[model samples]
Target chain A: MDVKEDLYHALLMEYASGCLDEGQSLIIAAHMALSPAARKTVAQYESVGGAILDDCCGKVAMTKDALARVLDKIDCGDSPSPCVQKSKSTMAYMNAPNCLQTYVESATWTDGKGGYQTISVRTSCHRSKARIYKIDPDTVFRVNTRSPHQLTLVLEGSFHDGRAVYRRGDLIVTNGDAVLHSDAEQGCICAVAQPSVFSVKRFVQQIFIRY
Target chain B: MYITATAVKSLAPRAPHSVNKPMESGRAQPKTANTNVNGAHHKSLLLRVASKKDREAFAELFEYFAPRIKSFLMKGGSAPDLADELAQETMIAVWQKAESFNPAKANASTWIFTIARNKRIDHLRRVRPEIDPADPLLVEDDAISAPERMGQQQETEAMAEAIKGLPAEQADLLYKSFFEDKTHADIAKETKLPLGTVKSRIRIALEKLRADQKVKELWT
Candidate 1:
């Protein structure tokens, strides 16, 4: 009950509708890892999505030899994805969902000229960009961008986005540069998803971003 | 925290639904295949595929889910051929992850469709790196929880009915938001409604489903 109740609820609904960008979705993933209530609520939304999916009309069967092709593709029946393995190993501290963790591992993070580094993960299906960022303790960072909609989730430590304190499992969604200033209480990592048409810049005024 | 009375009231001046009313479905929705109300048979079929490496069982699953997946992807705006290809990949994922499916947590229909959703996203990332519009609707293997007998299933039925009961414009918004993969901002641009109104309408629709007394009753 003490959770970031309304915000996560809205985010969960966005997630249920499949409208969240990857950055926002990843935040939900980590937040769910921290909150069982969020997990249960999210599960319910998934069920809602499932219920609707069951009602889609115009069912079509697969192409010829589809079964044969799949059987051939399977590594003798069961194929364990590497992402699942990583999820298990990293569950303790990372607390990131397997899907996001898989992407984060492969993504190339760029060290900004401040106490922060970032990796733009995936460009969205609708021309947005999903980025992950790392910030150091006691550091203040600024993102000057024209993203109409953006989402931020803290994977480590804590920070305040001028308006509220966001911790390891909180998702902060904003409209138009809502998080112009972020002061980290400790080392922090965040994933941000936004429209790709606009460029983003982060600055710490004067601080070295340790690799 | 529960929906605040103020937020719920501001959402829609008129609370459109009286939750506990027995469902009066005007739409004669198609029953799922072979009268399998819960898709329990599909789960058993999946179990066989997992434990026995049953090819026949997988083939049956392929027939049932592949096309539906195709429909799902296509509805979300994938090209027909691409949708077909992703559908194939989704079924393959199901084949590979059959052992991971837990009927106690989800029915097969829910499980397969969830996988289908993820596969579609994976395909999008692989083919087009520049496209980054995130689709948040994801169901993962680790997410376990059956729909409350009084909650999800009843909510689904009520939602379908609710969609029917919605004002035509609001109903259209729901379809685009849920089925077409359209964002609220995008919907506002298309419908010429303000973004705030679009967000409010979609959020209100969801609140309607979540506010169902049957859901609260079940939980309580």
Candidate 2:
């Protein structure tokens, strides 16, 4: 809460612009849930960026099939589980108390009720239109009928989202699914994060589709 | 190809409207694309640059980053022409020094950003030619202040209403601070006033920006 003003502003702009890395993004996202004021600041900055992007109507570059192109360029094939990387870094910083361990351990969680569980973290890492959301078990964590789906992947944990329980070695399909969800009790924790403005874009798309 | 001078350059290909057409396959695919070696790891882009012989990748990197560098330099007070020239130079440096790029040290954007910031500092020193880091003028005062001040004014319409309500000197400082990114020294230099006086005006300007009734009303 006592973050430097410069750091706050820098983080605000970075978070709003979807410029932060995954770790930073996750930190900010967690903060958004804890601090309404930070969330408001983020929303406010997003408004600023939205206005800028709007004014930039034709100024910002729009890659045709950019999502696809960037996706193809990435070599996700047989890549090591992201948790290994996370734990490795966490291990490097293991000097800290048990909190870091809990943080990584929380990457896989049980609902504590045995009813539902989260499986893995799914992220679409487009710089401006990035997102990281958790995939919960017993629930599809469905993108509403009018959501723009980006690249989805399992970052950590495992659970059955109405399909197979994708463990560490599983590669979830990036696209070609209209709807899906994890239904296993061994809850999954995947992220469905996206850029803040994509919701707005999706809203507009919804209106367009309805019209 | 004329390069199809469109209003905006599209970096990724978009799916065409017609069904018969298969989208051109090789540009880059977001989905099913090569899994990124670095997933937004701050230095992912720079790490990619570390390996030699990725010239096409380097150019793509340059194309996206150069304009941003130009904008950053210009915002920090370099002349437009100078910023543009330096931007090109920075890209060249990126190419020549790509081998030495270290992802462990800094990410691509940060590395490029540092290069630009350094270039601007170097340019400032050359243009001013006065060695005086001790000058209060060079101090960066844009350090994080209360977030409340940054709100509402983010919108130009709101800013316009707020600025209309500010005293002229205060308004001038606001413009100089945000628009020209002028330091206390530069503002003093421009207005022929003492650095202390410039700082006071900037504070007063911030007050008005902070207290804009329109912003207050919107927030409430």
For DockQ, the strongest prediction is: 1
lDDT of 2 at A155: 36
Tell how far residue B199 is off in model 1, in angstroms.
2.2
DockQ of 1: 0.28
Runs in model 1 deviating more than 4 A are A1-24, A56-145, A161-164, A177-191, A202-211, B1-36, B54-63, B78-82, B126-168, B215-220
Whose lDDT is greatest here?
1
Native RMSD of candidate 1 (Å): 8.4
Give residue B144's error in model 2 in angstroms.
23
What lDDT does each candidate get?
0.57, 0.39
lDDT string for model 1 (A1-211, tens) is: 2223333465676666667665556556655655556666766666555555554333555577766777787756544243322222222234354456545534345667667777555433445556567776777655444555556777667778666777765666655433333443466777676554544443222222333
Q: Give candidate 2 regions above 4 Å deviation.
A: A1-211, B1-42, B76-81, B99-105, B124-181, B188-220
Looking at model 1, what is the TM-score of chain A?
A: 0.60
Task: List model 2 lDDT by residue over B62-116, tens digit each.
Answer: 5555655555455455676666666666655565566775433223544454445
